[model samples]
Target: MVASLLILAVSGGMLWAVGLNYDGLTGGQAQKVHPASYLCVLLVLWQMLRRGNPVANLVSAAEHRPASCLLAAASIAMAAQIILRGASGTAGAIDTFLQAALVMILLLESDARSLRRLETLVHAVMAANAVLGIVEFATGQRFFPFRLDGATFETDTRSAALQGHPLGNATLTACYVLALIAGGGSLKPLTRLVMIAVQLVALVTFGGRSAIVVTLVLGGAFGLAQLLRAIARGRIPLLAAAGAACALPLVATTVAGLAYGGFFDALLGRFASDGGSANARVAMFDLFSRLPLRDLILGPDPSLVDSLRRITGLEWGIENPIIRVVLYQGALMALLLTTAVTLFLVEVGRRCRAGIAMPMIAFVVLINTFESLGGKTTLLAKFVIVLVALYRPFPETRIARAS
Candidate 1:
């Protein structure tokens, strides 16, 4: 319990740390290590020493061996690229290594002995973020003064919560919501419904178009799955089905009205205007297209942001994780990374009783499509822990005893 709480604190703090600019600690770079990283490092060291045989413990987890090998291979590939490219590539390479290291450390140190404990820790983190988001949205003021910008900190319409960007907040909320849905069977029906409702409200308040769309799709899919399950069991009453069919049109009308209403109009107004966001992504792609074949096979120029700016005359970073990985670390490495993650997700989905893994996977993919969440080391660490927990074999004896 103590270890779980500490892990939760470090993870939750890092999410909130995104919005902060620690001048002395980070030197104004948002990517640099902050207080949370220091705490996490200390916890990892303590846990490693306490265990006495870190290597044996790591090796004992046979299920994680493949993931470990894949991570190592990806690291080597990135390191080789950096060495070939020299000084300019060093920073990016170091960033990637640091992110990977943090994730590995968190996964190794986590004391969650079962999937239930792991889910509880994750849910606690999500709940913290959800509460902060709700407060930020209602009050139009952040609970913490962690701004990416060094100057002029002010909160207005958007609910940034602990994440620096509103879009990031929304994306994180969407991910948590999907996770909850996937693990809903672990909780009572009322508890699950309440948690889902709270998260949905928080996601809507954060107002990211990607979040909104992904949440809607996943929620609809979950509903359909439930309906199908009931039908399969002959549990759904004919009268209930008939009532649902008759009310479908009214529900559709209400949703349409809400979409055109003031709140949703304000929430999604940005996408309706000039296609700036879409165009920027296209511009990034265009810039990548002009790179030399050698660069494409090995890696692009070290100064990816600068190269994009030079080509497109716009100062924007890559938004898509797939494109970002390919541009930074060759296509082969990107494929390896994607395959590793996809396989793990599939494995978890196969093990899940509620069939929530597919929706969670979709949520991750959709969120990454519009945001570079894969680049965030802290969040990535949390994801690694979640994957590890899901991969762990269930304690059959404990389940039988409980039953």
Candidate 2:
């Protein structure tokens, strides 16, 4: 289990070591494929072969149908980009999606105990990273300096967690919070409460406005639903209540210790004005108006896209995968992307309780509004790991509901 989790963490891009710098693999950190990505490919190939070779394994198993369909659909976009626009057409975004898909496939084969262990590993990593985030914010010292190209550019605006992207860290931290609170990882009552506080605080340090807003709204909805369900049942369990009460003081103590150490100055400042993120989003859509209709409908040459970026004075390329698919892969590929994502949702959701699953999906979609998971991200990979770790089969849940 330890070895498996180590592979999983490294492959998922969750490590904190300096060696994981991911240099040379690709110059741009956001578009690079780390050494860990190669590890994922090897592990996936091994898993497929063990299941009776790649082709037969994917096609023959009834349980594999969902993953098979999703992969097939998603591959269309990636394959289309390569076939039509050449190997240089895409940045590393689609590669991230493919790596995440492979992670999901490997996880589906894990037994229940291994899944639980995986969740524990994720929780440990989250907690460690949260503490590191807090320290970085408190001391105004980041372990990993921000790199602009090959040069080290330092910043105090936000804590750069292990993965070295504040926004991505914020997104994953938010997802981790939702997953834990919604029910997944094994946690003692007090530990759970404390981690929630730590993670939420770390979230502020990372200062992702979208993650903060979406998490708050969805979290409130989930809380209300849980309360309503408990009330309708006519009673809260005495043991559960007693345990929560017992854990309250510890949770309070934990909060009191951490609360004053790091302030939300950065978060508050960004909330006032999003550093032109809103303007940038608006400008992205304007690219369509400027593009030739033919290029817009049928993926433009990547070089043409860049020339247009200069023409339009936009600062970045695609931030959202939904938009990226249409602009980079064309309209037909967009349909395939949507179909693939929908299939992935269904597959992941069935392994979790409906209450938890719905909110988690909502969180992913909301976070994606600001950035693409199909880009250089392990959010999808980690999210799927959490889902399976907390796995409660759909039929089992239905049986319980009926009873």
Candidate 3:
């Protein structure tokens, strides 16, 4: 499990690095390295080959956890949309579903201790992403090595860092920080502090208000849940510490945002002017209400895309998730897709209630509302949900102190 995750993270990081300066390259060169997304898929197929029997192979290939299965269904629905529409996006996003399946298999195969190790692997990957984000923001350069550019970080907005999109980068950074919250890993103080600081930088640099909001809300929710759990267990000191760490990001971001020029004011400005981003999102929601039921249920035709272009008077795409899926997949697929995600959360919540893994299902569920789990964000969100549901984190390990 550790090996596979490491491979996936490294491969993703590499691909992301190349993408940062992608503007300079010819289109043909860009296509050359694009196939790297399938590296994790290859690893999963190899594991399937090792399993021997036919039934075992089929079951082995399926998502071992309920949450993963739902996420897998989501991946399929998305891929089907792409196939049906001939839309050009990242193929690796689809491959990420395959990666999720591999992680699920590994979860079913591992014991509790191994599960924690898997968590460690995920945590490491996220930490790496945070570090990469910091580098990108500071130097305006890509982190991963590309076909021609060597290992130097250089600034270029045309090619955001290796992650391709600012939102995707923020998602990777946020997901890891959330994992760090759940596990309460080493350098707890420092990790929490860095996560808070970096999250602010990420949100500001990318202008990804949704990702920032989701991170703040989820971080607060997880922290509160842990605090309550600790208090009930008579671990008051730990609870206090946990509360501080969890609340720090939201607190810091709110203060910083206020100092820089209040976010609330910006939101109001958006609504008032209808030219600010907040109002744009409101407009998208308004447009959704006006879309026909038939289009909403069966997915929008290319005509709707043209209509969006006309109405928005912008010759581009929509950034909102709910509307995007509703427009692309129609109502029926949207309903089933939503049902699958809801069921996964129910299962994860059930596990948390059973005192199995850390209580993070609620946090993930909240985060999913603002960011489409099916889109370009980190695949680890899917892995984290399923791993928590399937294997459960190990019972806390007690290391003996020197006598």
Would you list the rank order by lDDT, best first? 2, 1, 3
lDDT of 3 by residue, 252-338 (tens): 877787657643443344335533444455555655676787777777775665577568753323445555567666767667656
2 or 3, greater by TM-score: 2
TM agreement with the true structure for every prediction: 0.73, 0.81, 0.63
The alpha-carbon deviation from the true structure for residue 53 of candidate 2, after best TM-score superposition, in angstroms, is: 4.3
Evaluation by lDDT, superior candidate among 1 and 2:
2
Question: For each candidate, C-alpha RMSD in Å?
Answer: 5.5, 4.5, 7.9
lDDT of 1: 0.57
Q: Which ten residues in a row have the lowest lDDT in candidate 1?
A: 87-96
Report lDDT per candidate.
0.57, 0.64, 0.51
Point out where model 2 deviates above 4 Å.
1-31, 51-54, 61-63, 76-80, 87-94, 145-148, 152-156, 228-262, 392-403
Model 2, 132-224: lDDT tens digits are 888988888777644533444444458876656677677777777887678656788678878888899888888888888877877778878
Ranking by TM-score: 2, 1, 3
Report the Cα lDDT for residue 26, model 1.
44
Give a tens-digit lDDT track for model 1, residues 1-403. Answer: 3433433344323434555433223444443444444554466566667779877645543344345445545655665765776623333333333343444434533443545687776666667767787787666676543344344245236665555456656665676667667664256755776777778867776777777777788768877899899989989888878877987897688668866665465566666862466776777677566777777766766576466666685443566777777777667767866775555445434433444564466557665756353354334444444444534433434434666
- Where does candidate 2 clash, by residue pair? none
